[model samples]
Target: MDKIQNQVRPVFPFTAIVGQEEMKLALILNVIDPKIGGVMIMGDRGTGKSTTIRAIADLLPEIEVVADDLFNSHISDYDLMSDFVKNQLENNANLTTSLIKVPMVDLPLGATEDRLCGTIDIEKALNEGVKSFDPGLLAKANRGILYVDEVNLLDDHLVDILLDSAASGWNTVEREGISIRHPSRFVLVGSGNPEEGELRPQLLDRFGMHAEIRTVRDASLRVQIVEQRTKFDQDPNSCIKEFCEQQNLLKQTIINAQSLLKSITIDYSLKVKISQICGILNVDGLRGDIVTNRAAKAFAAYQNKKEVDVDDVKEVITLCLRHRLRKDPLDTIDSGTKVSQVVDDILS
Candidate 1:
């Protein structure tokens, strides 16, 4: 395990990324306010969608987690722990803190049900006549990120499991006379090529925002991207050394932004605007309004604004509300196009 950890390469730097500003902004917004659920990036292959997400993971500031815990429980926020941990604390057990790597757990497409939710240790059960529950990817992802590539292609059963866990912030398993439930609260990020398969509407609604990415078309930008990648591949050590300083600076910026998010307020006018947008778009349920409001506020916070304004709301509307919009049967209008129209009308 130590050797494997040592061999793992660092993710690309988020600040050095080019193009896909909308996708980048939406992701940053979610990081600022995880209550906004998480952003889904859907687009063509080779559009840097996955690359951008992995890069952001590297730029994120480290978090303090409970030592020896399967779930990366935040040391500062003990209130968010499961009942089991709460009970342990109530019994006056020593709770240790350790600075751990902030998680960015990737869910592979070929993952099995056992790998997703975990299963009982049959060997231990048979030998010691005891039931022991092993933690899975979801457990390790707690208080951090759970990234799924080719999300739309994930098995139907796995999708259901993820949806339920994400909504409740817990994963419960019951089988073979053993029942276990653990905290699984993590930012759920998914990326996929929309052209290959469309995500189920139910799952789509769970995401707070969605961004579409496309390959950079500008000749110079494309050349720069290729040149940088080639240079990095040729000399990873020097390339990473050169970029590490900027990556560290960006990590600090994210930490500052997180602290700033708490002070940023949302104006009543902007709240009304968010509600109005949801009403005009005919989006179902109150989640749309809530997510849009939160995302706009986070965007403002990221910009160092004290309060959310019309521009902030407008800028983030396409990202927040796009996935929630109803598809038109007669019209093939893209979500972005519809959102732009609404923003223009509201601002005008």
Candidate 2:
């Protein structure tokens, strides 16, 4: 029964997902250049937030990792390697590698700190003199994606923990003076219904981009979404087969973009303009400027372009800055609108 339950299920192809272009673009941009950080998606309920996220993760190409490593340590990068992998390397051990689907870990709202960050078995340390540290979700999420549904409803402290690891690209566990650190670098994707609540500005700012989605209002598009979903539900395998071409095309596009991203460059003048917008808006930090630059380059790469232009920066400037703006409870202007206005004034 357990084996049957653990069998992999077919995912709805990412290309089949209709609408929510902003959310999809943000997710893709982050995947192309993880240095752009991750995205925060707030939307109406049942707006395909979770489905779209999962589809993108499933769409990603497999990565090679050191076999049997709990952290899914990259095959080469020392920083991304786990301590165990490092020790083996120091002892001149040859590491076996395996290809695996990019991990997509869901953070349940009720998770405790110890569960989220991992815990050290104090007894083993004291008695056996061995560090029996049990890995948690962050450890498993290395070189993958950590998704938090209903992120606004999650505890603030937990949100901090996630953002810290996402920003620093590492998770450290300490117990009874035994500290264990491992690579926890992963694309941090969080989605929630804005109707329920909103993450605080500080926590929201930690996310690289903000994408807002609403339920599809067009009757024709609505019908298409429903029919497509019905088809997928009726026969997941056949439905996936139907869109296999589009899915493969998109997956290849992402791979190409990732390879092209490093060569993608942005103009210095445009970067100065990005910072100007942030300054005019009184954005709290340089994250807005930095993310905008990275996202613009990623956007360019995604389009198979070698250099970022004004349009590329324009396309992502709002997403990169919207969540970082200071909240004025009395102000009526929407944050996104404010960002757009500033961008237009400066970049135009």
* Winning candidate number (lDDT): 2
Which residue ranges in model 2 land beyond 4 Å of their true spot? 1-8
Show pairs that collide, candidate 2.
Answer: none
Local distance difference test, candidate 2: 0.91
Task: Please give each candidate's TM-score.
Answer: 0.92, 0.96
1-348 per-residue lDDT for model 1 (tens digits): 423662477556677676789988888887887888887899888888888888787678768777777777665566457655677788988888777666889999999988988788877877898768888888878877889999999987898888678778888877776777888887889999988888988789988889888878899999989887787677766777788888787667667778888888887877887788788988899988988888877878777788888888888888888888887788778878998898788766
User: Best TM-score goes to which candidate?
Assistant: 2
Alpha-carbon shift of residue 252 in model 2 (angstroms):
1.2
Worst lDDT run of 10 residues, candidate 1, spans 1-10
Across residues 1-348, which tens digit of lDDT does each residue of candidate 2 receive? 323422457788899998889999999999998878899999998899999999999889989999998999987798899989999999999989999889999999999998899999999899999998889999999999999999999999999999999999999888778999999999999999888988988899889999999889899999999999999888887888899999999999999999998898887888888888999999997898889999999999999999999999999999998888888999899999998888888877
lDDT (CA) per prediction:
0.81, 0.91
